[model samples]
Target: MINIVYRLKSPKFFEESIDEVELDGVIVRPTHLSICQADQRYYQGSRPANILDEKLPMALIHEAIGEVVFDSEGNFKSGDMVVMIPNTPFGEDVYSPNYSYSSKFRGSGFDGFTSDLVNLPEDRVVKIPDDFNLNVSAFIELISVAYQGISKFTQMAITPKDNLGVWGDGNLGFITALLLKELFPKSKVLVFGKHQENLNLFSFADEIYRIHDVDDDVVVDHAFECVGSSASQSAIDQIIDIINPQGTINLFGVSEYPVPINTRMVLEKGLTIQGNSRSDRVDFVGVVETLKQNPQLFEHLEKLITNICEINSLGDLKDAFDKDYISKFGKTILKWNI
Candidate 1:
């Protein structure tokens, strides 16, 4: 089959290429693709120059939902809606799937789901309910990231906490806060952001506070740092100050530069900080099952999608990326039906 792929030849420029693909496994046509901050970093040349030089001329979308066109394995019927798991492990290992050193992830070192048709192994895709919206389903991978972080926190957290703090108003923070509420309904989930306007969108959070306005009396048993980039350091500082002693902090953000932490405070408080990156199939399965059991979570998640642009041509693809570049909040999704 002739596959049309959008590749980033340089910063803010894309070239379309036509290549032949073997239809051996499951063939999926992308219905919706969501641009992640990491994708933006690559497109804008914000990543390390060496890394960019090595990984450019690559397709740039990992978070997506697709419709099954054909399945050689016959595990899924034609026209089935599925979520593509971006992390493709080379082989089984003693460590966790995502932790495997030989893992090949789409949109990073390998081609992603930005092509007109993606050929994936049956194990790499999960079927969703027919009634689920594909646009919202595109966020499953991102939601699963947050789910994985929380899962890791549960394993490490020695004490149960009633209050949880999430920092950042971006899509990651929004999703993390919502998931925290859904999974632990009794816990008070507080969201701290720089912008009140953007923070207002987090209606699901138990309490929303401006980072500057948070009182000294307010404390959290645990915290999640969803603020990435240069702002991550500040978020971590605030978490260190407000989080209870012996608290476990989950770092879910990505920063290009090395972030400095208050080791003195960490030692004095006996704090534990854990870092999380891409998730595995089990995380995806957990998210799907949670959404299936609590469909209302989907409705709440829809609020995070602030913009959706249809990509019918190369021009449309550039426009979507440009719009996301300037977007101050929420997730920008590319409707890839074209």
Candidate 2:
């Protein structure tokens, strides 16, 4: 089959190319795609020159839900709704495959779902209910990332999880804190962020405090640092100071440069800093099941959709990225009509 792929030829530039996509596996026609921070970095050329040179001219979306157009194995019927998994893991390893060197990621290592049709293995696509909200479901890949991180954190942290603190007012922080509250109803979910306006959106949180405004008496059992980039350094410093000794510090942020940490504090406090990245198929499946059981999450997840743009042309796709860059918070969803 002929597939039309929309790739980022360079920073602030996109072009379409025609390619042959074989139906060796499940073929999905993407319905809704969500733009991620990583995608914006590629679109804006914020990555290192060397990395950009190697990764450029690739499709720029991994978070998306689509309809199964054809399944070679008949696992899914035509028109079935499903979420595409971008992390392609190969080889058998005791540790998670996402950490393996053999893994190939969409939008980063290869072409993403910005094409007219995506041919993926049957196992790579998880079926979703027809009644599910396609817009909110678009970012299930991101939700799975959070789910996997939290799952890992819970498994490793040996201390009390009474007070869980999430740093960052952004989408990841919001999602992490919200998930923490739902998963740990007995624990207090505290959100610390720089923007008051962003923090205000976490009405579901037990406590919301501007990072600087946090009282000295306040402390958390563990902290999830969702703040990446320039502010990550400060967020980590604060987490080290406010987090109780022997607590785990979960790091979810991606920083191009090294964020120096206070090794003395980490050693003295005996902190366990865990880094989380892209998730695997299990994580994706867990997210789908969780969303199915708790439909109320859709209402909260819907708030993250600040801008919804339809993409019927390359110009429309470029415009969506520009609009997303200017937005202060929330996610920009691309309705993939193209």
Candidate 3:
């Protein structure tokens, strides 16, 4: 089938390309898409010039939900609402394909969900309730990332989860803190951030504190650092100082450069640091099941949708990215009218 793919030909520049999509699997029409920090890095040319040169002219946006347009073998009916999984794995293995070198992730090096229609493997799409919030569902892939991290932490941590601290007040931090509350109801969920306005949105958390305002007496049994970039170092440092011994530190931040770790403190405190990246299919399934069981999660997730731009052309798409960059908090959702 003929498809229209909108790719970032250059920084702040997009061009359309004509491609033939094979009918080997399911074809989905993207309805709602969300902009991510990684997409912004490419749009703003913040990545190293060499890396940009290698990956540019690629279609962006991996977090999205769509309507099923076609499904081979009739496994799914037409017009079914489904969340498209971006991680295309080769086969099952002991380690997750999301962390494997063989996997091809959309919007990073491979083409994302920006085309007129996406022909994806049947296993890559999970059906969602038709009535679910489409805007919130657009970012389900992101929520799965947090789910993956928390799942790993719960499975490996031998210490108490009495107090859970989440650093950074952005979208990821909000989602992590909220999920922690839902998963560990008895635990005190504390959120630490610099932006008062952003931190205010995490109303579900048991406690909120400005990073600098945190009392010396306060501490958490575990910490999650969601602040990426150079600032992640600061959040990690603060976490190291306040986290209890044998605590698990979950790192979700994506930094271009390496963040320094106080190994002396890490050894003295016996902290376990785990790095979290993109999630696999199981994480997506778990998140979907969780959402179905706790329908109220949509209400909390709705607060993260700050900008909803309708995309009919490349100009509108550019406008949405520009708007997302300036906004201090929340997600910029693209209403895919194209």
Indicate the worst ten consecutive residues by lDDT in candidate 2: 89-98
How high is the CA lDDT of each candidate model? 0.90, 0.93, 0.94
User: Which lDDT tens digits does candidate 1 get at residues 1-338?
Assistant: 99998899888999988989798889999999899988998888988888988998999899999999999989999999999999998987797777788898999978888898999987899999988867889989999999999999988987667999999998889999999999888999999999988898898888999999989799999999999889999999999999898999999888878999999999998999998999988999999999999999888888878889988898898889889999888789889966
Error of 1 at 225 (Å): 0.6
C-alpha RMSD of each candidate structure in angstroms = 1.2, 0.9, 0.9
lDDT of 2 by residue, 1-338 (tens): 99999999999999989999997899999999999999999999989999999998899999999999999999899999999999987777777778888888999999999999999998899999988999999999999989999999989999999999999999999999989988899999999999998888898999999988989899999999999997899999999999999999999998988999999999999999999999988998998888888899999999999999999999999999999999999998989898
Q: Clashing pairs in model 1?
A: none
Q: Candidate 3's error at 145, in angstroms?
A: 0.4
Candidate 3 deviant stretches above 4 angstroms: 91-93
For every model shown, the clashing-pair count is 0, 0, 0
Instruction: Estimate the lDDT of model 1.
Output: 0.90
